[model samples]
Target: MRWMSTVPASDCGRAGTKSSEARLQVDAWVAKRGGERAMAVRARARLVELVAYARTRSPYYRHLYRGLPSKVTELAALPVTDKSQLMAAFDDWVTDPAITLERARAFAEDPALIGRPFGGHYSLSTTSGTTGKRGIFLHDARQWAVTSAMATRMLTGWLTVRDTARIAACGGRTALVVPDDAHVGGAVMAARLRGRSRVAALSVHRPLEELVEALNDLRPAVLAPSASLGVLLAGQAEAGRLRIAPALVCLGAEGLPMAEHARIGRALAGAKVRATYNANECPFLSYSCPAGWLHVNADWAIVEPVDERYRPVPPGEASHTVLLTNLANRIQPILRYDLGDAVTVRPDPCPCGTPGPALRVQGRAADRLTIPGADGTPVTMATRPVAIVLDTVPGLDLFQIVQTGPATLRLRLAPAPGIDPDDLWDTVRARLSGLLVRRHLGHVRLERASERPQISTGGKIRPFIPATTSAKP
Candidate 1:
């Protein structure tokens, strides 16, 4: 609270190297005001500053904002930046021209490079190409500190101070379920966690069974894993196949559906289940507000929802693309960088009364599905809804359900290590089959694959992908 009281109102729109620092200052100022209106004003001012920075520091922004108005009254006045745009100028767009795609790619390809910093100080990570193109991102020291602070805020915001104190009292070990390879985000997280002796790091790409075994052996009170995988573990608890009573469960990387939330909650024997919404492209974005609404960390990163033309859409209106500006990572200079996820802004103030903007993501734009309706008509299915069902099942950690044909579907799964592959297939097939008419499922076949899974081009994974057309519905 004291931190919020220290925010400087003018810092809300200040650009350049001190953006994050200034954003926090603005946060303190908003906190001092003691309510929602103050936060909204701060958010508006912060957006203005972010656009100002983009117009000046980012090449992509210069082209996007060639003749924009002097004042950014609406977020739409700013451009809707996308992945292709930022990547085109990947080399020039970064604050540091020395960090190139070739250099980042080469660094990411080497597994041995895991846990090592890139360019002497910056942490490097690569995106899993579920969206078709892999991305390389960097986080400077300040960004890391900001991210850590925000993460702590997220956790504490979910649990009461007393609960947090009690959880810490247990000396609960944190097991981060993330990619272990040299891909930028996972590697950075792995490095930092490994450096901390108390926390344990586990690879999400590994078999779910093995991950479960490790969890059982370690008995960590903190369970932080990708949302889908967390749901899988919850399912295992439902089936009596696995059990762990962690004090907290933080889900990320996928949407946590209400159904899956119930399952995970039940599986955890009443433990709190919270969601973290972030990606490799931008380190600190939003955390779930106390009211369970995802609130953007407007002080650190600026997120804009834009239409096809890159113009901002009305709040609560659907966005085809998400443009992000990372205030913390000056080394990469991510000004209005496009993140490939479809998101919607919450239309109203949160019950929790946080001043930051609230969001309800429709899941990654890539995760939706297209299939024939029950009447034989083509139907576009959204994966966010279906994935909720998949996550409730136990043992299946990573999955890709590709519809090879209208009636023929092939499911690729990377089960928990040491799990009975046959059992996983049965559970997944049964759950998936039930989602549709029994006849449409001509034959449900499951296979094991080795590729690491990630959210698709739209910044989320497609639980159901139509083979004929590559686009997600």
Candidate 2:
């Protein structure tokens, strides 16, 4: 494909010249008519432009919209796509012919390619593959710029000039706690920031003591981590084990329970706790307003809440799933893509004064498992690693790991078509056993489930479920 460098001279921080320009433009967009009417008008126009471009450049879209009208005005008339369908037609799905799935997979697999632009042209990221199949997403130069600009705007919204100056005085370093996996979105973004600014991309896979030590040494001005990890570290901070006073604590990737948010807030009394809603599919999907409502960036993206049958859901009601359309990304046309997260759009305007429909997301909920440590004390094993292991495995369809007991794990698998169940079970058991052993839970037992796993009433599959309180490690 075209591996051209699209990053501006200044890409990351609000202080950079290019970042300042982006901030100005984004500010202008928001300032016009309080950003409501202006954003809607612009989004409609951009959606039309993007649809026409996708039809002309993408073979998959061209065929998908074969008989559609030349001047389409309605978005619901278009077809909806999911991860499996898009990945199955990867070559034709992309606007560019040279960007094949094979090349993209290789690029994503290599640890050396982390943080660097793929083929020196597109910024690439992939989903966790927790739900069965992984999705590889690409962004051309223009799209990447938009992502950076939007991020800068979001960060600015959370931190004021005084906050920024205070952070800079305290070393200006950002500690990003994410999985070490090279292909994940958090790692890719962390690596890119590390290359450009004073940032430490700390892996969540590291031991708790080691992570705390590293954070203590870094004394970062900003701390970013998944919601689960943030809650764990908050406990550490409360116990005086992990000590760092960050100006801002940004949490993403997974949903943050209100209790956990309050606990973290209590632990870090002076820090600003900001929770955001985003994914690999569209990093700038939405940002949390001061009142803790997620406001969509309608100027650059569209989120359509829908029912189970793909029909549009009304405001104030929870959707079965949301359709995400990234207006900024041209290389990969993410038009009407089904993002499995359920969300609710506020019928009224946000009290925070943001000029768009506020959203409440019901995202993934994977519980952490506690197992006996070397000293027989409870050791918490975050579900992220388990998810990574399962996500990377091929030929596996729907699966779940339930911690029936302190040291017992029951695995439920729904294998892909033509796959031998016995062989798949053996492979999964071995890998899982090895991972548990490496994490110091060597005594844990793995057993195949005699019964099939059931999806929740909400139609969500949780990969990790902790044992009962009586069975605590």
Candidate 3:
């Protein structure tokens, strides 16, 4: 939810749509070239410009690159930047000198400032820290407008003429199931689509019954939700409880299993499901294709799927982690930035025939937990609500909740630097226990584990380990 871009209520100005159209046309032209080398050439040129601008503006980059050559034309020439490294130099990482970490932190945390721009020009957003490294991102109006336009392009690609007619008949209403508090994305989408369509915002944290009822009432023509929420709603529809028939169901924030996506698609009366690959740092990364690959927008951004030692991994092989470079956003230059996610770049061009690069996501997450209620019925919990409860716990970014038993659960945490482990545990226990009590899940035992969060087969930390699975991750 906080991962989505928020444009101003003024629709990012009238020029926004025109600029978007222009970007779309440029992207189309690049794709038509249908050559990876061509896309790489453009990305390399942009990388040179971005590197020059970042070195001149950002003190952090200037210091890091002080030993570098006068001209950096190759992507591999620059050093890799990680979250910890960049965040440590927070005050100087951004190109803008006026945007301080303290004020940006305060702005992103305030619910009242969710949709509002910072300094009346930049929009503030925070990442959920799925990889155990939370991040705060700032985008200028032009950057956000690019995000908004890219999003529009993605949706337009997904929707068919029949889908468009259906949406129009349904009053052009769109429903967004996003994080309740840190939902800057939902508000921005609503404001951006104003007059053209009505976007109803719903929380992913709401109880299953409540969420279903809300959807039924809204009866939205277009629906976008986290993967877990969509699956739960699919279950309700399978039981003949939920009856709304949407024209499309776009998945974001989390991953959806193929079986679940198929089931949900059938249950939702064949609404097409499109999963997007984006982040707070790079909002217009890639969009999923029916062929199951995410086509990277190489003209505007660069992704290097690399090995453990920062070496480029061969095609068809999964990389230890991927690096992202956002060329469209010069205010906060993200150049060869370490994005901690496992991915595999395809050896062959996509069958969908889109130009540039395509890849498979190795660590797309799905956080869903179901427990039996006091009345013998099951209670379902998704990522957003659980993230709201646990992500706020100070000194805790790397933690895992494993359902050890029908009612017993294990909580493993890795405290941040300088944080008292015992103190962090005590605070997290209290917060989680309170949530359980409120949700009538107090009977579920919360066990404190001596072990830290386990590394998954994909080499990332799994946030929630379901009871149905006996193995870790």
Q: Which lDDT tens digits does candidate 3 get at residues 68-102?
A: 99789888888999777877788899888888887
Q: Model 3 reaches what TM-score against the true structure?
A: 0.87
Task: For candidate 2, report its TM-score.
Answer: 0.88
Q: Could you report the Cα RMSD, in angstroms, for every candidate shown? A: 10.4, 4.9, 4.8
Residue range 1-473, candidate 2, lDDT tens digits: 00111222133212235655465355434533356776776677667777998999999999999999997777888899988898889999998888999898788767677778776677888774435456788867666566666677678677888888879888889899976665678877877677656888898777777888999999888899888788778888898988788888888877766767767777865688888788777887777877778878777788999998889999999999999888767788888888888888998888878666688887555357878786888887667767766655556766888888777889988787888989989888887777777677778889899766667776666666678523311
Better structure of 1 and 3 per TM-score? 3
Among all windows of 10 consecutive residues in model 2, the one with the lowest summed lDDT is 1-10
For model 1, residues 1-473, the per-residue Cα lDDT tens digits are 11221344343223224665545544444443455545445456545655666567666566767788866767645544455566667776666657776787677667677768788877877653334344567777666755765666566567877667757775867777765544546446877677686688886544445667888887777888766567667766776767777778877776655656667877887777777678776766776754567777765566778776677878989897777766555566565666766788888877886656788777442343455655675544434334444544544556776766665566777666578877977887776666553325323344444454546544455545666645322
For model 1, how many clashes?
26
How well does each candidate superpose onto the true structure, as a TM-score? 0.70, 0.88, 0.87
Off by over 4 Å in 1: 1-78, 365-473
What is the C-alpha local distance difference test score of each model? 0.62, 0.75, 0.73
Least accurate stretch of 10 residues (summed lDDT) in model 3?
A: 1-10
Runs with alpha carbons beyond 4 Å of true place in candidate 2: 1-33, 394-398, 413-434, 449-460, 468-473
